[model samples]
Target: MRNDRQPDRPPLTTGAGWHRRRRGLAPWLLIGLYVVIGLAPLAITWLRGHPRQGLAHDLSSGLVMVGFAMMLMQFLLSGRFRDITGRVGADITILFHQLIAWTILAFVLLHPFLYAVPGLWPDPAQAVATLRGMFGSDALRSGGIAWWLLILLVPMAMWRDRLPIRYEIWRLSHGLGAAVIALAGLHHTLTVGTYSADPWLAGFWVVLAGLAVASLVHVYVLKPLRQFRHPYRLVSNREVADRIWEIQVEAERRPAINFAAGQFIWLNLGHSPFRLVEHPFSLSSTPADRPRLAVTVRESGDFTNRIGEIPVGTRAYVDGPYGTFTLARRRASGLAFFAGGVGLGPIIGLLRELVQEQYRGPVHLLYGNRVETQILYRDELEAMGKTLDFRLQLILSEPPEGWRGPAGELTPEVIDACLDGRFPKDWLYFVCGPVPMMESVEATLLARGVPARRIVSERFKYS
Candidate 1:
């Protein structure tokens, strides 16, 4: 590989440090709020004057109450709330959402089973009769509906890819199903719950259900309305590599959405934002270039494979500036980037920002791809090398005849060789890639003494 060097200029100053401090507090505050609200029903139940129940009965009631609270909280953690996801990153928030869903499912599943425990009631046959009455009762119809819906929803979500349904259809069904579950769960809680008979508990359920509905409206209605007012037009779309294309859009009669480097947007091209057709793509352009945003997408999915068909002047909607995978939040003596294939999208934006800001540090990149043709923005990356103390190491799993760059997977030996075994502990590291590759690289970095805080990564897909 050829080495290109350029004179470095002074780095630009900004209020990023102050912003980082403020944003850092948001996740903890949100978590605190979640814990308080989720446990509020239990706390209120304990305070209220209620008849004493056996341990199994009390435990069963407590499980369902907490489970319902968690179910309601799922609305806020849907990867749409910037206040909740701004600092933690959307991937982590969504991962938590999925994990928490399973937990709540388990709780709900156990609620009825525990009530049927023979030890809970003096007569085992009486407990069985009570269970049958609850299951067959007309008043508990909503509870039965919620119970079955939850049973179906979690497994369907887990095996969504294997289902014979389009992504958009699945999304629509998921949203509608969730709404039904929330409403049914709320009905059951207020009407059938022992503690919920209290005025305060009933009011709490009403408020949570209202918030849940509001969250859906915010995502499906209000957000699209706002996007309609500030739309973007496609400036250009061209193939950058074998299967990757660069999409550039210019805001219509407004400035582009302000976002830090390495952030992403939910891009909807030639479709209204109200539709569930948008896909998340990392911005491949720096904040320095406003009113014009770009994203590099690989032709992997159904929507992405049809990128070539998008007209040049199509109107676009962006719900964006999301994700915490940026340098603005962390300070470092140097920077290192490890990107694989299309994972270079966000890293490229960060590199451009470093160049634009004239960052004076030893910047290194270890970019891995399967073949040479898939390597994107080669010429521009080389130009960036000329503007900063940057080193680019291209790694290919398969190389052409007589190729001289590093070859094979991004193993520990390969990474050590690329950095010359000088892995800085304080330098910030950015990684974006396939899950296996990312897991391998992260383990290697941790083993090599890199602090976990110094390494930031964003997963491309959750499922």
Candidate 2:
């Protein structure tokens, strides 16, 4: 093994003035706020001291109220707000959003069942009768609308890929469905809620619902307006690897979008920013390459398959610099990067940023691909070792003839062999790839005693 170690590595660049600073609530504080908001209605209702319904009836109301609170919060969580995602990272935020969604689903779905529990014992037929009565009640019409929409919508999101609809259509439907659920649920609550008749409790529901709708307005309306002012023009588009493209857009305004490397952007090319034609792509160019932003997109989806044919100088609008897959707010004595296929997009950006900043830490990359031709930035990666303390390991599962190198999936054996048991406690690990690969790599590192906090990753798809 050829070993090249820089004896005196310089200080970390993350906390320095070089990268854009990200500030948000600590994870504990954020969780605390979430719990408070979700339980606020329950607390307020308890204090109102209404004549208590029996345990089952009260429990049903409580569950629906908390679930409704959480459902409303979902809008803000998905709005891509930096203030919330800054400290904890986008991965944890998104995972939390997803997990809580399932919880909300459970709570809402159980609402009617719990309410019908009272009629279940003596005659099972009575439980069905109770349910039918609840569903058929004219006063509960808004509640019924919300209930049915939840049944149809949540599954649609979970099984989106299985559906025949396009992603844009699904996204629009999801947003509109969420809005309806919020409004209908609110009307149901204020109209028939036990404690919502109180002015203070009704006022709280109104305020929170307003904030929820405002979050949607912020993402769909306000953000698009801002993009119009800070417009960009697509300057170049070219293929970098098999079914992969690198696209660049130059800013038409004064200051470019300030972003940390390893972040991603939602790009809208030759379409109005207000339209639902944009797609998210990882930033392949370093932040130092600003005023001309670039994203590396894979031809995997409907919109991306045609990216290669986009003419140069097309009007482009970007709504990002989103995601926390960067080293901007972290400190690591050494860096280990794992990328599979097109996952290299952000990793390449991080490496380029390190080179531009002259980072002294030892950086090792283990890039995996199915075949040699699928490897991207081959020359650039091979040349990195000459400039920085870098090591490049290209692992191909299906090597061509006369090839003698690491050959396999990025398994535990592959990872251990690549790192050679170095800095398991100190080094920061970045893993980006397919879901299964990332999950397996993350579990492998954890089993090797790498602290969970030291690993960073971002996920766009969730089940």
Candidate 3:
């Protein structure tokens, strides 16, 4: 019998499981809260019959700024910032984040009209006149500019694909725009009345300003300073299969951070966090060896495609040891790994960890690629299998001529064949891949009597 205990992975312990009941439905809950919060100001305005005479006058701007901050925090917590935080994958997490962003935009559109307009809201001309009228006065100029900048930037960012800009460049520009908007907002707060005058509102602004500054420091100064103190020089960079690169780094520090098998880190390649362009790669090294680390990365996306160009001997910043997608905490009669495409990064890391730990448990590796040419770390996996006590099975979806391994997709029959009826049903399974492959593999596994609890899958979706 396999041990079914699930100790929470340390990296994922910071409030990740706290919202378990509200995971998928968190957006709806946030929406309900948003509606309530928005309505508070409107209700105040309704009772007072004037904009400046109620709590809404004090709370509206603060609410807007704080709400924006909350939504951004949601993005960070949703795992979209997984590269920096090293938490979970940004799969479904990003979906919730997007929902939050859209919700904020909707509120932003409605906020001004409820307080500024007189029964002419939802009317295009009146809303335009209300916004345009603010720009006429010197006192309201900063607020008008801030509001315009936010309105322009948010929509441009929401429809980034239509914009004539590359993702990497757009990311930098978007960050700059946010800084401008924030600065303008600060100027407006200083010049405006109500919320800007109250000590509590003033304190809230100070705290928000501090948070922004701290986040900047965390990404730039603190993380980089730590890296400088514990220098990790790049030792080897090999071009693995499917144009993926395996980077081996040697840490000079005495007590380097230890990570479990199948974890990942955010690599800051000469770009400051202020630039908003760091990338995440899965650690392909074992945890037993603490002074060194390795990560295999596929050359996809704007940031990842530049990995091939990263010169060796260049210093890199690593912020991680995150992700709960490892095989460390589970006990199973047998272990199975299902990897698709570049999803092999974590699997390779886990295998190396298993070898270092000298795990005698029966383990299996089922990897899939489009073709033989796209199979990454093939020779390395072959060598590792020879030395380690684990079975290896390669599946090619689009195998060319002269291929001898299993062909076609990873169906239930292929899984049964690989496990040799020793699957033990209670065994833990780790799966990593694109959405469709993961769904198919999960469905097939469930059908074959594998309990949902026995399956640990990480889906990596691009936003």
Best candidate per TM-score, number? Answer: 1
TM-score for all predictions? 0.94, 0.93, 0.74
Instruction: Report the C-alpha lDDT of model 2 over 94-113, residue by residue, as the tens digit.
Output: 67777778889989999989
Clashing pairs in 2: none
lDDT for 373 (candidate 3): 82
In candidate 1, position 401 carries an lDDT of 85
Q: Find the 10 residues in a row with the least total lDDT in model 1.
A: 1-10
Most lDDT-accurate candidate: 1
- Candidate 1 versus the native: TM-score? 0.94
- How high a TM-score does candidate 3 get? 0.74
How many residue pairs collide in each prediction? Answer: 0, 0, 0
- lDDT of each candidate versus the true structure: 0.87, 0.85, 0.64
lDDT of 3: 0.64
Candidates, ranked, lDDT: 1, 2, 3
Ranking of predictions according to TM-score:
1, 2, 3
lDDT-best of 2 and 3: 2
- Give the residue spans of candidate 3 off by over 4 A: 1-66, 69-96, 121-131, 155-167, 186-194, 252-255, 268-277, 301-311, 328-333, 379-391, 401-404, 412-426, 443-454, 459-461
Comparing 2 with 3 on TM-score, the higher-scoring candidate is 2
